[model samples]
Target: MRVAALDDDVEELDLIKSTLRAIGHDCHVFTEGAALQRELRRETFDLLIFDWHLPDTTRPEIVQWVRNHLQARIPILFVTNRRQERDLVEGLAAGADDFMMKPIRVGELAARAIGNLLGNALKFSREGAWITCAVEALGVDWPVRVEDEGPGIDEALQAQLFEPCVRGRSGTQVDGAGLGLAFVRTVAQRHGGKVLLDSAPGRGSAFRLVLAQAPDAPPPERGQGEAPA
Candidate 1:
């Protein structure tokens, strides 16, 4: 993916650039809003990352400009040091798809969440079965759905599907540690959201990861000895 990142701080820009590149994305860094805008006029990018504060602009002005002027529905993410509720509101109100604090680990969280979902879908579904992935906007939440035409899950197992090391009856047929869904649940809850499953004996499973449009607070500290399931 081609990504455009704007930040006035040199160190922050370097961090953003390196992190994106490490995840196989082409990242273009800008020290000023004008430079980024100039590039946007002549080039295209798959994603945009913006800092809440810019030396020449107020909060989210560039984001507003992009929403107002651009025709494409590109995903925009805000990575900044600001943590106030109103700052989050303003960023989302200006049309950012997601908001996160500074000192981020780049795409690790998203990659892990979605990766596990897709991996499970592939594992559970029979060979050549259809697996669909989609993103939908729901009022103040974004839900990523992964639907698979696999042997549907039982209600008894669904209840404990997100629990660590828990698996369905069919789990024994598949090679897994039963940790994927648990990790997905943890990631969603940390963002003040949740993971939901829709399935039945005959109907295939659809896993929906719903995340808040903007974070309400900083991620809670993990408990001592906590680890991914």
Candidate 2:
């Protein structure tokens, strides 16, 4: 896939480009928004990797400009450190396809890009250790389910569901710094969807990422991947 990485940070740009190139992707690095827009006007890329903050512009403005002005529908993947709900929504509203945080590893980025291209959902197992995933969004109604036999969530945990540094007190080690819910929310919203949470003290929590269809998502490959285990 051909990718466009827009950021003012040179190191980040290099890291993204090099990592993407290493993973069988062609990347075009951009240091400014104007040059990116100029190129955008001239050609189409398979995917976009952008940042929330640029040298002189905001991501939402650029996203809106691209969505409103451009005729093609290109999938966008945001690599940002901002975790504020408002920031997430703004990016989603700006026409970004997804948002990831800083301090990210290259493998996760590749999985996300590959998943979006192939129409997949990336998640973790109940243990939160393995990368359990599924392809081709489920064609069911809203209020889906993510029920499992793992540790159940509580009200406090629900409030901190998508936040970082949250853990359950069942004595089992919970992995991650709380990037899952945030990532899930970002992915769901970008596809015109929402994430539903229903957790019990003993029963496992069911996180339903309810989403509407994208206007022009590529045809989904038949079921071949597994959901978060």
Candidate 3:
């Protein structure tokens, strides 16, 4: 599997890299947040592994960043010391596919990695950590809006806001999984839908999803279920 490992601690990174290599997976390690962000443009990994804290960004922020910036439903794993249920819930809410505590579980990591690889290959299509599917109970028309802080789609291209594999040039170093957005776009179009980009350079982007009610979308159960992403 193509795995990306991010951590501020050099020694910890080395140990994780060694353990993963022993299992025979290609691992990419990044210590600097900006460099890692840049590298995301260049590569698409099967698994993304990182710490809960980073020099430049928090785990939740990085997760949210990926949801906002990339469309691919790449499985993300968190290796961190944040062991509280609240912490785990926060991480899960932020988009972590799974969260593992520190003092690393090498064996479990291997299993989870294999499982994530299989799970992603089998399905792997969605927008966020959890999918914002239509609520069957809601009326046909729903409140939705598209906001863009950039110049427009034209500027989105300039800013690398579109799909990674789209027309945008790879001038900026980015290690991104280049598959999700295309699916998002395709699915949205199939449903006679559209995505609104609420963003701008230095401002940020938020894409509002609006769709016709899905006759197939199941009703919400008692427990909060995972979103489609």
Candidate 2 Cα outliers beyond 4 Å, as residue runs: 105-229
How much lDDT does each candidate structure score?
0.75, 0.61, 0.56
**Better-scoring candidate (lDDT), 1 or 3:** 1
lDDT of 3: 0.56
Q: Which digits, one per residue and each the tens of the lDDT, describe model 3 over residues 26-55?
A: 788999777777877777777788888887
What would you estimate as the lDDT of candidate 2?
A: 0.61
- Clashes per candidate, residues 3 or more apart or on different chains: 0, 1, 23
- The residue-by-residue lDDT of candidate 1 on 1-229, one tens digit each, is 5789888889988987986576455899998888888899899877788888776776567877787777776678788778789889988988887777765542457667877888887777777778887776666776788888778888888898887556664443875445568768867876678889999876678888887755453443322221111
Query: RMSDs, each prediction?
Result: 14.2, 16.3, 14.6
TM-score of each: 0.51, 0.49, 0.47
